[model samples]
Target: MPPVEEETVVFRSRFNRILAAVFWVVCAAALVAIGLTYAYRPTGSVAGLAVGSVLIGVAVLVVLWRPQLTVSDDAIVVRNVLSTIVVPWNALIHVDTKYALTLITPQRKVAVWCAPAPGATAALRASRAQGTQARAWTAASDLRPGDLAGTESGRAAFLVRSRWNTLREQGRIELGTAGDQRVQVQPHVASIAGLVAGVVAVALVTILL
Candidate 1:
């Protein structure tokens, strides 16, 4: 028989999506407002357009673009705004959901930038509900309970834990082999440098004009 392919799961922040949408809308409105107020004066209009571009660029880079957590049978991928980190299943020691979806490995702890845990009050409520659901989780060990899936961070942690347990049972995760290979964190240095350069160039032009 052919080997079964592992399933891939993605966890993303609901609040972050809403926040990103708001940022995008705000940037669009700012640009529209600048265009509507465009005067005949070339210098003033150019400066206003430059300011609008700067706002759009900053919003796109910072607020409108958020991170994501992807879990698969073999590894977990953390896609932050400027960097991406890939960690193998065997390297993950624990999944924590205190302040965020944090992955604890033998070498270091990585926190997911997008999925932030709820506040104390909300978490307490979710925890109480999760406690009840956790007792019934044994029968459907492979599935995530609805109670525990209240928040993005909680859901991400639960998925990671479930995959970790499944992999361990299948003897796919070798704890002893952890830390043999370092996790890879790749930053989008060129993109960030270009953004910085654009901002500086616009600022210099605005000043000179």
Candidate 2:
């Protein structure tokens, strides 16, 4: 028998790119404003420039460069701002979307940082108009109409469930040993700590001056 080809699916928010672009624009505007202000009054305190730098840094870290979820043949990779988590398909009991995309295992539930569900109003609207948007909804037995067609998190979950089902049907999913069952979460402590320290330092300087 021929081996089944594995497909890798990536789920990301459509808004992330737009928001990142906006962040960059805001950062550039801030820099230009600071430059013009400094040019007009050379004697002005450097606090303005410092403030602009902090703003840009925060925006870049928090909004512009956010996390994304990738579902591969072997595992689901969650790339967060300060952490990365890889959960094998065998380890994942199910995928859930309430406020965000969550990977459920027997031991724990891990939430994805990038994909967030729609707000209450939007969700209600989505529920009411579920069947009308068949084109947007991906076909998956594990996925709800509100989820697969309604929100970013839903769509991500659908893709994940679809792939999982395929693998299971092909007898590719296997029960692993204790070590393999554990979720792999790697945190970028240095980057997160540095950002926090920088923010605190800026705050202290702003207050002291």
Candidate 3:
């Protein structure tokens, strides 16, 4: 038996990660400010505000920092806002980036939230900044904005498609396996529950104030 060699890649929105980093700094400062304010003049409203602010900040961080996709030779783990999708390469039928980086399988279509298709303005900027070049895995027009190699969705889709094509050509993906396999989709129940709780706490604090 031979060891499985792996080359894993993780992708996230650069803008979102930067925003999360900035928000984390703001949260740290807010905590310090709240602590100082509480020490100086202990008040119930101040306590309420602190609690609400913490809850709100944490909820915001989860939204900003958590969405990502991890790719390996075997599968792709897509961590969306509300759910996660595990897509094995054998189960994939095609890749599409109409709205986002999407995986089409026999069972369903799964969208990768982190790799959203660039809007017209963003796409135009990308095209001008880096020429609208067609990726190696695709023969579509260079002007196909969503399929252009410069955009986020296009980049992710290219990785997925390239890997799939390699496996297909090498005969690693079994012919009948697609019908037998299903991609796993799981909801982020705990995260969702905590977010809901935070929202309720914020609402209660707001009402009290």
Candidate 4:
């Protein structure tokens, strides 16, 4: 037998915790200022003032502290507010999407608790450089989460599916469901949109109130 090609690389979803934190901080500060200004205003009601202040504070904390997802060459990791889980590819038996991507493994099925995975992060990075086909594997965007289940190198494929399932639950999970057995992971704009809308609402209320 001749030499075999192989593609081995680890990939991770981006973390928005810092951005979330900053957003919350700014909102909180603005809300506090507004609350204080209105607290003593002759035209403001005590109930309205109190409600706005409390809601602003709580929203800041909650929005700023959501979960995150981590990926690697052999596993899909989910880090939530209170826990972290690492799922191996082999354990992932089925991967489906609905309200979110659901991962069914031999052990059990669990929701992913992290930010959505970006489209082709690994493939984009990999393509930027030139290397062997690494087992003659095609571009990742051309592979589906289920197709890998039947392969000898299905480990990585399994992880990708698990990650997709996890993301599906979060919101609109974008995957290129094209070709015979190919699934393309696409960037999800809804996650960012939600975050922005939430921040803007809080900020505007804080500043204008």
**Count of clashes, each model:** 0, 0, 0, 12
Give the runs in model 1 whose Cα sits over 4 Å from its true position.
1-3, 40-58, 61-66, 124-148
Winner on lDDT between 2 and 3 is 3
lDDT of every predicted structure (CA atoms): 0.72, 0.73, 0.79, 0.46
Taking the tens digit of each residue's C-alpha lDDT, what string does model 4 give over 1-209?
Answer: 53232234342222445666666677667667767776677333433444455555554444435454456434556544334566654455565432234455655565553323224443344433334453235444454322332221233335565555555554333343311222223333455555456666655655555
The sequence of per-residue lDDT tens digits that candidate 2 reaches over residues 85-107 is: 88988888877887778889877
- Tell me, by TM-score, which candidate is best: 3
Query: Candidate 1, 4: how far from true, in Å?
Result: 3.2
TM-score of each: 0.79, 0.80, 0.82, 0.37
RMSD of each: 4.7, 3.9, 3.4, 13.3
Report the Cα lDDT for residue 11, model 1. Answer: 75
Best by lDDT: 3
Q: The CA-based lDDT of model 3 is what? A: 0.79
Runs with alpha carbons beyond 4 Å of true place in candidate 2:
42-58, 62-64, 125-146, 175-180, 204-209
Model 1, 58-167: lDDT tens digits are 74655436578888986899988777899998788777766678888888888888777778676556656668655466236643222257767767787888888888
